[model samples]
Target: MRQIEYFVAVAETQSFGAAAQSLAVTQPSLSKQIQALEADLGVVLFERTSRRVSLTPQGRALLPDAQRVLRQARRFRNKARSLGFDTDIRLVAGVLPSIGAYFMPRMIERLRQEMPGLKLSFVEGSSSELARQLVQGELDFVLASETDRTDLARRDLFTETLWLCSTPEDPVMQSDAPATLSDLKGRTLLTLSPEFHLNAIVARLAAQAGATLSTEYRGASLDAIRQIAANGPEVGVLPSLYALGEAIRDPHFKVRRLLGYDAEHPVVFYTRTSSPLQALNARLADIIILEKQAIRAERAPQFQV
Candidate 1:
């Protein structure tokens, strides 16, 4: 392994002196290691000349395999270190602000209880933004809506229905009957910014029902939309869990299921396909799913009405 490392260092730096400097070894020692490696492989690994040093055919063929070995070795070391009693496991995770509002407090509490040594950092963003960060390696995992992106591996967490929210003075709240999509026609529908999957879903619903989406009242988050809807006749679309958890208790808001409209968003936990944290990520996903199921179970009767 040491000889292979020396060979790789020489291949990368293309100079024994530079490779030795980088590896903190004497130049002659580095050269001896490489010579031993070439002898064992029975091939010349590099072609050396006064002007430059380049890989021989054998070395060119071996470079990719050597890099893969190095990567796997590093991963092994990291996994071992993570298991140490004093090592703190750090993870960066992302979640949709709307979903996080509903479930994160409980989920985070559970994580703290179960994995005391794990240090978690969270970032909230729209589904699209979260997916982009996951792909860019900025996030280890994200809870978001299912997307068409092939670069991410997704696990279905739960599906939540959409609700129509408005202040008591809104016309839709004048009667006990549930409001249908068509009832929203000619009324301003406020929604989160387009980067959100909920925004896209609401846009489609409005288009299908001939309702006008409020261009001037776009919100950056569900809270903003709910606050805006409180001041006027505008209706805001929100996920059922969020509505049940927060909006229902607010006297200024009326939350209702849309009649005849089966609008639901499937939430998913996703990580990069190449991620090394697959097992840990899966465990976290399971925690979120269990918490969501518990919440829904507790709120079932309220939502049924």
Candidate 2:
């Protein structure tokens, strides 16, 4: 298990020094462990050059099995700890910045009220990063988009419609009509960094519309992209809740539904299939879905225009 841990750390970081620092061990110790593991398996696990380190085919094949073992071990430890006299529960969760920005406040409040004995911590990152953390057992569950991993359990939570947002003075906003995909032609589209699922969705929309996605202004969050869109010429692709929240408060921004484009982004909750916290995680997911549904119901009238 220790050797497998060392190998996984090195594989993930792609740098022995970085992996050693992350694991709080000396580089030589990590290297020795990995070397011993390779000897035991009788195969070279990594291709190490001066400039970079990459996993070999043998390592790639074993990586998922290693992660599964680690996840199960962690779950066993956690389960044992939960059998103590303390009835309190601790959960670590991950969420993408875009989803967190809109839903986190409400979700936190509800959790505090409903599950007072629960100790909750959250990490924010891109959807892919969140998924990675979940798979590695660092996170108990994740609120993110659907992932391709078959080892994780996923439940569809809700769908958020994507809207085109621009400064009020932009020609598309002034036209007194909903924007269409073709309306974006030759225009600049700004979005979150490519690691975000929303960015891929926006890029596809741009490609279909014959618009240019601006690589020069990749934003770290929805707010960052929204602020950039307020400067004009460049438009933003935003989720309905974010667009409505911003547009209602800031007269400078205008949001319109996109015509002839499928703009729904499905949000889902993910947990390891073998998680010991499955029951509690499902309850938490239910709370999130209920709150999200309530918000959507209340705000549905505002978006009708």
Best by lDDT: 2
* Candidate 1 clashes between residue pairs 3 or more apart in a chain or in different chains: none
What's the residue-level lDDT of 252 in candidate 2? 56
lDDT of 2 by residue, 1-305 (tens): 89988999999999999999999999999999999999999999999999999999999999999989999989888867763312477778898775676778778778788877677778888778888998998998898875667788998998777777777787777664668888888898887788778778878888889998878676567887877877767898887767777767776567887765656677889999988766677778788889988887877776653
The clash count of every prediction, one per candidate, is 0, 0
Deviation from native of the Cα of residue 38 in model 2, angstroms: 50
The best candidate in terms of TM-score: 1
CA-lDDT, candidates in order:
0.79, 0.81
Over 1-305, each residue of candidate 1 has an lDDT whose tens digit, in order, gives 78888888889988888999999999989888888889898999999998778999989999989988888988888877674322467778888876667677787787788877777778888888889998998988898886778878888888888778777777776765667877887787787777677777777788878887777665457888888887777888878767777855664466877764547777898988887766777778777888888888888765653
List pairs with backbone clashes in candidate 2.
Answer: none
In model 1, the Cα lDDT at residue 50 comes to: 88
Model 2 spans > 4 angstroms off: 1-87, 175-177
Worst 10 residues of 1 by lDDT: 79-88
